[model samples]
Target: METQSMLVVPVGEETEFNVYVSTQWPTLIQEAVAETLDIQSSRVTCHVKRLGGAFGGKVIKTSILASITSVAAWKTNRAVRCVLERGEDMLITGGRHPVLGKYKVGFMTDGRIVAADFHYYANAGCFVDESVLISEKILLHLDNAYNIPNLRGFSVACRTNLPSNTAFRGFGVPQGVLVVENMINDVAMALGCPADQIREINMYTGPSVTHYKFEFSPDNLQRCWEECKLKSEYGIRREAVDQFNQHNRWKKRGISIIPIKYGIAFAEGFLNQAAALVHIYKDGSVLVSHGGTEMGQGIHTKMQQIASRELHIPTTKIYISETSTNTVPNTCPSAASFGTDANGMAVKNACEILYQRLEPIRLKNPTGSWESWVKEAFFEKISLSSTGFYRGHDLYMDWDKMKGQPYSYFTFGVCCSEVELDCLTGDYRTVRTDIVVDIGRSLNPSVDIGQIEGAFTQGLGLYTLEELKYSPTGLLYTRGPSQYKIPAVCDMPLQFNVYLLSDSNNPHAIYSSKGIGEPTLFLGSSIFFAIKDAVAAARSDSGLMGPFTFDSPATPERACLACSSPFIQKIPASQPGSFTAWALDI
Candidate 1:
């Protein structure tokens, strides 16, 4: 499923600008349209019915499209529509930044990480769109669910001759987390210890401070890890995998568990604010408008549920209208997993104000229905409309010192995955996967579970399936789905089970709910490591030992190459016939 970039702008009168588009931030588009037409922001209105699927892709890029289309509409005094074809979209709008991370860590034989030094270089194509912000997030989440005692990490955004890479699902955190996870796996293998043991020894527990100086008072990573181990029968599965590898010659089985502690806020403090407008009619029907755009992530559904709960009404009575700039202005882009934490709070605040207004009327008629109380409040000439706004408090960060609570809170999860790998063809299949997440008293269990599944699948593609090929002239070769592979139904695990943590409550945000957008994403890398485990088993059969490294998108080519064997060693190198490669093959 994909949504191509699109924008529709209709100019009215001289300075009245109107935009209809699929975007996560209408305010950003409105400002762009206004600036393109050289008019005041009040004269511009951006309307967003909804987006098909925008995993932060439309957050910033849509503004440029809307602005370009608005210029045509302004000059011609007509509606202008600009939509990119699938190929054009892929070639013009880039995806996640290709990050190269280098790190060295010191750990004990018990698999505990003592100290680490790291450097990360990101391929920030032609223009630096959000590369700086992405780099910052990479540094912030390098310690994914683990406690790094002594750490020094630096990041660099290298300019490249390619399309500018914007935002994806996990931003740059997954790349950073992958680097650390790979390091831990290497450490575990070097010490001849189980990877899970190393992870557990380094896992955060009790009240502790992060390397960035953030307070991790109620760490739930260990809880999730324990639950995942129990649910997945990890001990039994590990033994089974070992037995299978020992018995099988060509095929081997491997199992791995990964834990995650994702922060739930944007790197920038100002982007952590949200606003909502709520209006209650005399018929008890409520119309709610929030700054967060619905991109099939169930943000609107969650917001509606929040309003309904606050107003003491059924969800059917509350309706979330289309997001518009005229209703709520200056909205932050719906990224960083903070969409629900910030926007839901704004919606709840609006509903709370309306609830207070109707309380007096309801008290007069204790046994009255919601409609009757609403009518009474209307007859009493009480205000039926209110605007509520919320800004994050006490969230700050200094680059020089790198000390402060950059996140409102952390969401934790753990996943255990088992896979069967065919060493000959480098083909693999996930036998079973068990995931445990701490989403803090979920607003909607179904939505949160869907988010976890979707994000994990996307992350799986990033680490094991999706591979982008580009030409030397900065042209993308995999410009469509036919070439670029996203995880399909067949790519899913054969037996998949997801469980949210029980008896968990977060004090931050509304109703003790934490963000579920990007937390489970990095856990998908478990499949890659599991494949690595299988490769190790294959190598051992060939009398090979020690820690070996492999790059991501563990495609068939790389996987087969990593599974060293006498047969692979017997293949002669391609006789070049005095030929040299003409283009980059990454």
Candidate 2:
């Protein structure tokens, strides 16, 4: 996490506001500032250079600071700056929504999920801020790459008296996916079969249709699954884990494989659009500005490449200045992993327009250099600037009918994780991890790989390491790094391997590439399931069997308690007339 800062200066004849902030939604900041100051929306212009780190926090929370700073500048007629300290940010800003899932699943002897009924309640905190959208996302992704025939579910964001929870990296999809995964784990335990067996048998293969009516033929998710299994030597590792469990009493090892089929788009249909402005100078150099913000995700680089490809120029000649409301107005937040998909197309369209204008000049001198053709075109008085726009097609949803396609496309991947646990102390370390994803002809292999690695590590923190604590009075106790826990250097796996599936093509996006930002994130649940597997081994040694319930954020205390032993069962109960019983079950 990094400090979020913004500066506002009141200037110009019409009392215009020029704001500089690191935010994903500059238009939103402009609108909020204008409204707070009771001025015209056009009176405010937001300039976004880049964000140190947002993930999703700045999509909405950033407007609060921008509005406050704008108000101060308006009152004093001087520049004002607002910066949030790390500790202050944590105390005021909310994290991922805490989910309480209730579910009942029915399966066959061979591990096919026949029917599932789920009711998920998400804590929305003191106010409703995009919680309904989050709840809708949870319902949309209830069947995570699996084929559940009879599925019925409802999700609601319950109100609470606390800080409002906001958007995170995976939005609500990861939480929803975890529900079905936990059910599969329980079913495997009940049948004394491997969880991967259940996953394979229930996976969507060949031609399948989702509950929301999105159809897929020749889905690449199956290929990713098989390829991950082959590359990870899954069968051999399973046997090794069994042997390790048999030989060791105090230490246990476990392994798990999880698949992902994530939809790529904003649930709100109108938000799935982008606009760009491209200006080609007389010297043959290009400047590109798009609605997407750059937060170290390489969106600008991808836009540069797109422009270069469309204009038949070297990448060195293309420049992406900054995302500003003055250029592209009313842009959606650079979120939902669609920044590249939506903005790349807009940039390409603008470049194509300029390319067509210069085509006749190029044909006049077939062997001429690009600079010569541009010079001729400039002499011919051809326009060198263009504005482009793109909106998602056939993307709509009607919640009343529970139908329509809300996603533009799906991104698929698989991950296999292995972990060794100290049953005595509940400490664990990741031994090895293997991942395979279908990014569909990567735009930049290095950037995509970094995204996959960083997302998985963040998900690792969400699923196993990070824990939020609250007192009985609803005060947050884990309000800073000293009290909270996140993944660190020592938490990484000793051996890690990542591979991109070949021959995968996505026709819906630019350059046949799919969104890879959020797909690999849910794969981090493999680590959580692996920890459960290790605890299951310890339970079996104590003669405990059958299915058991386990919650997320498998912290050390929970992991130690999950390894139920004879000693734990032998603890004596308090006397009938003893002092007041302990309040908590622990």
lDDT scores in order: 0.87, 0.89
User: Per-residue lDDT of 1-586 in model 2, one digit per residue for the tens?
Assistant: 6667899999976989999998989999999999999999898999998889788889888898888888899889999988888777876768788888889999899888999998999988888887888898999989988899999999999998778888889998888889889988999999999999999999998888999887885368889999999999999999999999999988899999999889898867888889999998888898999999999899999999899899999999999889999999989899999999999989988999999999899888989988888888889999999999897655888888888788988999899999999887789999999999999989999999999999999889988988877765677777788989989999998999999999998898988998988888898999999999999999999998978887888887778778876666676756876865332121
Q: List the residue pairs that clash in candidate 1.
A: none
Angstrom error of the Cα, residue 480, model 2: value is 2.1
Best candidate according to lDDT: 2
- Residue 286's lDDT within candidate 1 is 92
Candidate 1 on 473-543: residue-level lDDT in tens? 76788888899888888879999999999999899878998899887888899999999999999999999
**Number of the top-ranking candidate, with TM-score as the measure:** 1
Estimated TM-score for each candidate = 0.97, 0.97
Model 2 root-mean-square deviation: 2.2
Give the CA lDDT, 0 to 100, for residue 323 in model 2: 94
lDDT assessment of candidate 2:
0.89
Candidate 2 lDDT at 231 equals 99
Residue-pair clashes per candidate:
0, 0
